[model samples]
Target chain A: MRRDRIATDSGRDVTVVSRNGAASARDAAAFSTRWSYARKRQLFLGALAAPALVYVLAVAVGPMVQGFLYSFDNYNLIRPGSRHFVGLDNYIALWRDPTARSAVINTFLFTFGAVTIEFVLGLGVALLMWRDDWFNRIALGLLLVPATVTPLVVGLVFKALLNPEYGMIGYALAESGLSGPRGLLAEPQRALATLVAIDAWEWTPLMALILLAGLKSLPIDILEAAAVDGATAPQRFRLVILPLLMPAAFLALILRMMDAFRVFDIIFVSTSGGPADATNTLMIYGVKQGLEFFNIGAASAVSTVIVVCILIMAAAFIAVLKPARNRHA
Target chain B: MPDRARLSLLARRFAICVVLVIALAPVVWLFSIAYKPTSDIFASPPTLLFSPTWDNFSSVFRYFNLGRLLESSLIIAIGSTALSLLIGVPAGYALARSTSPRAIWLAYFFLIIRTVPPIATLIPFYLLMRDIGLLGTWWAVIILNTALNSAFVVWMMFAFFRAAPASIEEAAMTDGCTDFGAFIQVALPTVVPGLIASAIFCVMFSWNDFLYAMFLTKADTKTISVALLSAYGTKDISWGTLGALAHFSTLPIVVMMIALNRYFVQGLTQGVH
Candidate 1:
């Protein structure tokens, strides 16, 4: 009824539904507007969403579906798929292989370690800078420089700076009480940890920035009230800030963890999965096996695992964000 | 004391200065190495007062075709940025204006695609490149990069386009301009900041990217970042020369960022709003 009324009123033309038997024309007019408004909003949302749909289909859905199809059979360079189904052999071997196992472990360790450290350090830095001064502004600009640099370039810089002989960091650390030649990349136990540190160094600023933004946008009244009530700094952070900041913190975690787990640029730049596979992340291993070694099946298996992980994380983030969005709304 | 807040402010100022110094220290170390004598680099207690020299910088150009390497990096970075802008800007405008449910969904999908880790597809990407025989070509670099970065560009530009009033474009359309012409003439200028931000981000990511550059290229096509990685293995890395290469390679990016710090700041804050 509302749709028809809106259509008639707008001169766009429509089929009118008259409630002549019981309802008055005034009520009918209101009813028409109610339905038409809903339709217009629907139309608005639909139009607002169209290009994004096309882009996703073209870039994302197309690629993954293509990648998935390629995974099932041996899509070799020369053979280009003889078009035979190999079943779950790829999945099976991925579970069995020692290199695969190591890759899995490294990926997990990298993700967990890098995200944790980056978050903590990021949070710490964010709090320290939260006082809001000229210094904060300057620090904000200067600090993001590292985060802004390409990860590959960072790896390159670290490669030089961590060199055993003349690498500035190696030289300094050795003189100042550290062991081995370029232990960050060279030492087995420390390589992953070092990568975590490097990841932290690079991405923590991003976390800080995001958290800082969240901090600013937060209601100042809460903090002021807490302070007026004689709440300690820790208490204030615990009760008020933490609750409010949860969404951003979680968002940052999801982001950093996603990137860290699949970290390739820095590892590639620095170690190349060195010291007998200490730094061989899943993504790196997949690339090595698939692209470098031309083992398409293995690579696909690895990619599938990674995609699953991403989907899981993304789902969790969405789940987390919904409540936050509601609260804001 | 209630006045302690003032004291805290002073302390915070001091702390910031300290952090800034610490951050600058490592980068400064790079600059110092590029100037220092090789013997002085590992000199006992490492002399901080060594006189600066141009030898390292000179050796970089002489020893490696550093100029060509820079060109390669620039080609890859600039080409990717340009390509991303071309596709992303239009997609953003269309998504912004057209009340198409399908398009909005695609843009969100693009956002997810943009955010997904590129490392996951390294192998497939390699194979794809090899088969196309574009593995070592600039086209390969640009295509992969544009693909990887365009999603980000679209997301950024979409939001920027949203900030622009649809009425402005429509008004232009009603007057004399075509739809495309209105977007091009009016909407494009309005979204300059967003475009600048996206371009900078693309350049930085592409310039600093190592994995694709490493996997995709051979000697003839190596980017600066890749070239730096290979520096050590190239007939034994002479500290002076390698340091020089690193120094020069780092300069262009630094200069670009420092010059456009406002864009960098704007880019970070834009999405959150």
Candidate 2:
């Protein structure tokens, strides 16, 4: 008997019997057993996956497509029946508007500053907690508490703590004349930076958690080998660990960058995009247009811009970090 | 231990303590505010210690309808999580067991779905809900959340189910078990931790979400996070009330974090790999 093998994409072999007879008879035999089995399997898989695919397409993709169309029209909810399409005018308006321009700039600055600091501080924290023990475990749990707090609440906590007249730290700093008379948040020049610091504080713990998880996953034998070769701790980290840890670092950085770019909850509650528009990010601007002002078209335009920015940034990150990943592999 | 080694250990412990303090201080202060007398809350030079009170908690109850808010949050979170898991886990298994090369790209498509800016979809989703007569209801929020979260669940569980061995299921097949039976009995049991991790993530994301909740929910269906928004209004600036509400909002997830610490770490690292 001769056996025929069907190869799967994953390289698994599914064997079937090959028969000698009239071509039609042989084809019928194959269809009844092997071909039907493969067909059944594919149909089963497709059936399993179809629900989620359909749900996302309907609930998520449908609205996204509608929103993209809305971006081209002047569809202010407040003005309901007077809607009209204006080709690329909303995008042109975003360019001309100084606040929108500031928002775009602020968003970039916030993402870069917060994500960089979080990555560095997170790596440091991860290193400190590397020597698994009872104390470190407890510390790890405690440290993640900040991350678990709602971002809006995080803003509220900071706002209360940084209130100039009565806030503990804010009062002391203001009384001692270290900070500005009003408060850190009240000063235009310092407000965005303070929010960035606040963003770092709320999120650094999460960054640390992801990086620590990554650190724990690093093969100990490789590190030990590096040590046995007489490399110092810093040298080993630079040469051996960093290269191996690129994927985790890439993950952590991308996660932070995505969230930081959109940086809404804290900014919404804390600054409301303001002290002279210092912290007006794309999210804040978009929400203000869509929700507060009911300018759906303008809001959709702003939303589209943000989505495009995120896509470009994600592509850039993949382009830059994927090469490192390929090299590691 | 040698002197140098002992010193290094001490330094490490001390550094960790510092990290802990910086990490927990804002949170501790927020919690402390709920217990402090209203008078002491804003005292210039800030009283180091004062009599504690439950007035903030009482006020939170009076104003916020604490029970109703918590119920809404629980419904939205649990509803979205259950639905996501139902649709997402099966799809993840399908992708993982797939023989097609295009399956990996489909997994990446789900990843990209997660990064879709909320503003992009949320506005139209809001209009959609309004048109369908579901706006200001928990279902409105639940449906939108399921869309985003199921995508995430699909991606994460794909990574997990991919990492899991298919050989066990194949053996079960050889032993006369059906494919579906093997999946339920053998494959599902293997990825229990992943399933739990994905559920935890879904719950956290849904529970902590403010944007969708704020947009979709009305006075009757407000979640705890949305309630916190009212507490922190520009005019009133009720620190005590905000703090008290914050306790309820943060505690459940915080407890979940500590309880499922192992899976949290595992899910994150595993998903990446």
Candidate 3:
């Protein structure tokens, strides 16, 4: 009888038999109309999302996946016919190859060094610029000019300035005998550090901006309550402010870390991973292998390693931050 | 003011001045070089006081085909920005308004896409472009840039739209506006700042990008960023030519940044949330 009633829902208007049956049919009809309305909405939303989804999957993900696959093969563009599967040889060779090994280590050093200095300096700048004033506002706008200039150009600017023979700073430093016999970039010991300084110069303002945003977003009353509770300025900053600023700090650090790990343009133009490969980084190595040497297999391997390292680092950040976030929540 | 407070304020201002000088000096030096004569550009002491000349600027324009490089850059930046906004803004709206449990996750997925290292995609993309016969064309760079930029736009606009009120769109729907009409007429107007911010970001990133432009473009299609590299690598290491080219490469973006910084700050703050 229930099955017959359900089947009759399709043609209930024509097949109304009793008052109870007619009432059931009316409810079913209403539910069906509502269901169709939701379905239509879902369809409309899905239509809107489809283009981007397709494009990303096709253009971005497709190449990345192919690159990953290429890592597992003896892929060489120059000798395309010679290509074949080579399981973990490329990965193994990265460890065996001294240049590749240095690239990985140098990338870590660069990421950590640049991000650390940027964060520290950025936080200081943010604190100084915290007050809503015209001076700070204009200063911030001017400060961001270096960050706006292409990183490639920033490297060139420094390269020109740091030329020991003709550069203003470099010539002075060389003449004073403050730097090594060679200029800053020419000295392997000083090159990476110099690069870090350059990176900080380019990126620290942006960091400050992000941290400033976070600082501004903190609730004023909460801060005042902390102050009224007899917290000193330093105590308040350490206890109340630092905790609140973590999310923005995390964003800043992660963004910087990701970019710094792939420090290409600056290092490429400045040193080209030279001074005895002191500044060799993953990106510089990968580009040299893939583009310059046409060693696709080795290049793809480095690329894969980089992606893996980034994922691991990102995961580590989330894991570290997750507990604090949960506690706050 | 009290002496102690006055002292602190002066010290703070002094420190800020120091920071500003450090930040602006390198850029100032680069800009100043564009006006310096060739001989003075390579001056051993790097003399500060020299008669300015437009010779370097004229030489860069004459030799490097400055007009063509800037045109390519403008087209690539504007092209990618326009295309990405077109595809991304609507999708961002849909994601923002959707009722599905997975909508937020999809938005984050787009955010993560922006972090994918260029190396991971560059090689295969090179081959893909070559196979498609678009290897050296602006379209090749545009296509790759659009993919990345549109994903960013999607994520950014998602945040913008979510922050925008849904009540107005619902009211529009109740007032007989179609769903698309509500989005276009009522909802879109509220996110104009977001649109501008996203456009600015796209232009800046695509404009500053040298790697993709370097790898994908032929001589005629190279961007100013790429040209900046070749200028540095010239046989004579023409600092004057580089300085002049740097003006083209960095000035427009810098100017845009200063002009639109308010939107940048607003957009960044909103997006991070």
Off by over 4 Å in 2: A1-5, A8-32, A316-329, B234-237
lDDT of 1: 0.73
What is the overall TM-score of model 1 with all chains considered together?
Answer: 0.85
* TM-score of each prediction: 0.85, 0.93, 0.93
lDDT of 2: 0.86
Model 3: lDDT to the true structure: 0.87
Tens-digit lDDT track of model 2 for A240-327? 9898787788877986787788879999998899999998999999999999999999999998898888887777655654565466
Listed in order, the DockQ scores are 0.33, 0.61, 0.57
TM-score of chain B of 3: 0.95
Arranged by lDDT with the best first, the candidates are 3, 2, 1
List the candidate 3 regions with Cα displacement exceeding 4 Å: A1-32, A316-329, B1-7
Best-to-worst order by DockQ is 2, 3, 1
What shift in Å separates residue A137 of candidate 2 from its native position after superposition?
2.0
lDDT by candidate, in order shown: 0.73, 0.86, 0.87
Better of 1 and 3 by lDDT: 3
User: How do the residues A9-67 of candidate 1 rate in per-residue lDDT, one tens digit apiece?
Assistant: 54422223332433455556665676675565456445434444454455455556666
Which structure is stronger by lDDT: 1 or 2? 2
Native-referenced TM-scores of chain A, all candidate models: 0.87, 0.88, 0.87
Q: What is the lDDT of residue B242 in candidate 1?
A: 60
